[model samples]
Target: MKYPSLKNYINGQFVASNSARTIKVVSPVDGALLSEVTMSSAEDLNDAVEAARIAFHKWSKTPIKERVQVFFRYKFLLEKNLQELATICSEENGKTMSEAIAEIEKCIELTEFATSLPQIVTGEVLEVSKGIECRTEHVPLGVVASIVPFNFPSMVPNWTIPNAIALGNCMILKPSEKVPVSSGRIAELLKEAGLPDGVFNIVHGDIEIVEAICDHPGIEAVSFVGSTKVAKLVYQRATNNYKRCLALGGAKNHLMVMPDAIATMTAQNVVASMSGCAGQRCMAASAMVGVGPIDHIIDKICDEARKVVPGENLGAVINKESKDRIEKYITEAEQQGAKILVDGRGAKVDGKGGGTYVGPTVIDHVTPDMAVAKEEIFGPVISIMRTNTVDEALAIENANPYGNAASVFTQNGGVARYIIERASAGMIGVNVGVPVPREPFSFGGWNESRFGVGDITGKSSIEFWTKLKKSTIKWNPEAGVNWMS
Candidate 1:
């Protein structure tokens, strides 16, 4: 059984890990090991970094139009193998085939959006300051390390690496050790698309390798997407190493319903927003807040949530530990005053709960200080918190530690506008369920929820990849090439 002998894609080749130590890729649906991947260590990360450092010169100097052509081909290759990509994601990541396909669609959009780099990378020329015509041009910041999360194996890579590569920066990616195969496969496809050697490298492993990648002086920038604590660590280390970083942290997204907001629709949106991706998404709805019909809204939400029966081809948590942690949170909540409205884990499951199956568990009368509300469960669980007025709801939301993505389910445009205006979250969705930022827009969290300055994709990505250098071109015919002053 050949399982794509996973290895670090360095210098345009698949380099084997130094040790035979491997991480087994498992299917959360049944807790089956889909494949075994040899883990890369700190030495392997150094090798990949060295390879990227060597490849950056030619890759960066490569013509922008030529680079764009590569992306066009890459898009075609991705579409041609969309099903294969989907299968890989489904097998290892536990996302249903449909969800996996959707993830690919997001990657497709990112690459398509990225091909427009020629237009986006356009600089401006201002003719106002004396006889000087100041012009700006974006230049790649050498080698960059893009660390992606597990839940979003392919989509996240697109968010970080594409922008880095499109803007001429060579990207050395360290995918999650859990689902490293999909990312490694993507690198192969990128190679087939004719991206130069070392233009985009792939390495997979644990903190040993990740720390090395973070501490590497040669890595000019680091873009990380993971938990808040890890993001803080990466940011602190990367900055101390004098490298730039954009580390997005865990989120406790709130979906508040105003008293005037629609009830049935809001409930359904909350269900999908919180349960989609098995609540593994960074912006997954964890806390539900609103002023109107708190009791009725809770009932409506529970009704809709019950619709998400386990083994209905939704998705599973990343691993058993994650699933267990989610259960622990629920169990502790039970010990607390909160009551479980729908025990997705215990109610009914197609497979065993021992396997990564946590359907959509809903809790009611959850307080702000509760562990369920305070923690980032990263699973299909919702803690319904009530407020007396819209003011109280907003205040509750504002008090939370995380402010990643929040949405409002109100037909009332005034209230929606006010929420959008006043909410301190990074991404806001009105009627939309998931507030993941598209390719053209920046995606990030706020406060302790996000670290450093840029986003995974969108405009901030472009900025993250390049260093803006202002050239003060003073050509008065007075400053001749040979004449000083």
Candidate 2:
């Protein structure tokens, strides 16, 4: 399938970048050449920032009722083009069709959430003293930007776009060069949804563009989702420039299986957690702890993992480099004495000879000292560790530096509670593998998984995207009333 010409969307128009350097967008599904994205220059980023700056004046003043109307229309247009977006997402990112559709569905859900800003964005009013009242209002920041990762082209960009724009802030988005096609489609849909010109823009590039976004004086705030190393850099640079920033980083999420866990359910959820999206997601579970005697459940997990075929059940990793990196981890773990219960090396789809496929891999008896048990593989691989007690399991979880998410599977509420309260991750689950919070609950992590304050979604997003403006008023001073008199 031929894709639309990849170009920078600045000032509401699809324009070619000033930079001559370009990168080919290859489909991870079959290694087909999808498109060539221009490596947007610093000048191109300037154009986008300028466009957002220009739009912010009118957009920020636009009534909240009117601002939400655009999101309402966007939600409809996203639903209308759901299938096309999903196909683009799956082809470029190498997730399954179902997962791609689910990502777009998440985008739609966030758009729906954005529409509720009219009701939820209200301020507070209280009487501080007699005849004196103070009130606070949520006000939009002028020009803001979001730097989204490649894993979820639609969902991650939507994470900031909906809330930022709905709160009346104009936005410039820098999408990962790997999966730029879906973002172009999103730009078109937002335009169709009646979003005003320059209200939202897309600039495509590599590190240069990222540095530009971080340093651009016109941009008031920045949101980022990527590796912890890069996330920290972006956060420091953006905040150094005195812009509000939230940078979500990498994770090595863990899942604990207690002795009382239902074998079938635990196996299903554990496999799904590690293998979903080829384990490209930050929320994907990479480590599993078997507390007490759960060898029976571990055997079931291995069986389920073996059943996951590359093309049928599991999807390819982002590229050949990612595939090689994931396999290296598996090989190193095996050499370090960890057992490869279900090896995924050399897995492939018959017709997709060039696809970067890696089947579901499980490494058992992975000690904390092993590199595989420590680093983020960012692939469909699971490292299993055994512990004799729940404290040991919780200790393993807490010791890990990345605290994005942790889950425990047990019928016992006390065990679940103990883990939930002690787990260092910001998101916790009982019997749920992926514990991404639903709408209005906020999504974020503690420690290395996240940087800056507040979350990137739900109610927390409103705060990240907007500023609080408080007004204290006294129409007439009452004589000797409180200290103000």
Candidate with best lDDT = 2
Estimate, for each residue in 369-437, the C-alpha lDDT of model 1 and write its tens digit.
898888899999999888777678788778887879888877788878888988888889997667877
**Candidate 1 Cα errors over 4 Å, as ranges:** 129-131, 347-354, 474-485
Q: Model 2: residues >4 Å from true position, as ranges?
A: 477-482
Clashing pairs in 2: none
Superposed on all Cα atoms, model 2 deviates from the true structure by an RMSD in Å of 1.2
lDDT of candidate 2 at residue 241, scale 0 to 100: 96
Each prediction's TM-score versus the true structure: 0.95, 0.98
What is the TM-score of candidate 2?
0.98
Cα lDDT tens digits for candidate 2, 1-485: 36765999998899999989988999998999888888998888888888888888899999998999999999999998889999999999999999999999999999999999899998999988888889999999899999999999899999989899999999999999999998898899899999999999999999999999999889999999999999999999999999999999999998999999999999999999999999999999999988989989989999999888899878889999999999999999999999998999999799999899999999999999998888999999999999999999889899999989999999999999988889999999899999999998899999999999999999989889889999988887643378743
> lDDT per model, in order?
0.83, 0.92
TM-score of 1: 0.95
Candidate 1 overall lDDT versus native: 0.83
Q: Which pairs clash in the backbone of model 1?
A: 259-292
Span of ten consecutive residues with least summed lDDT in model 2: 476-485
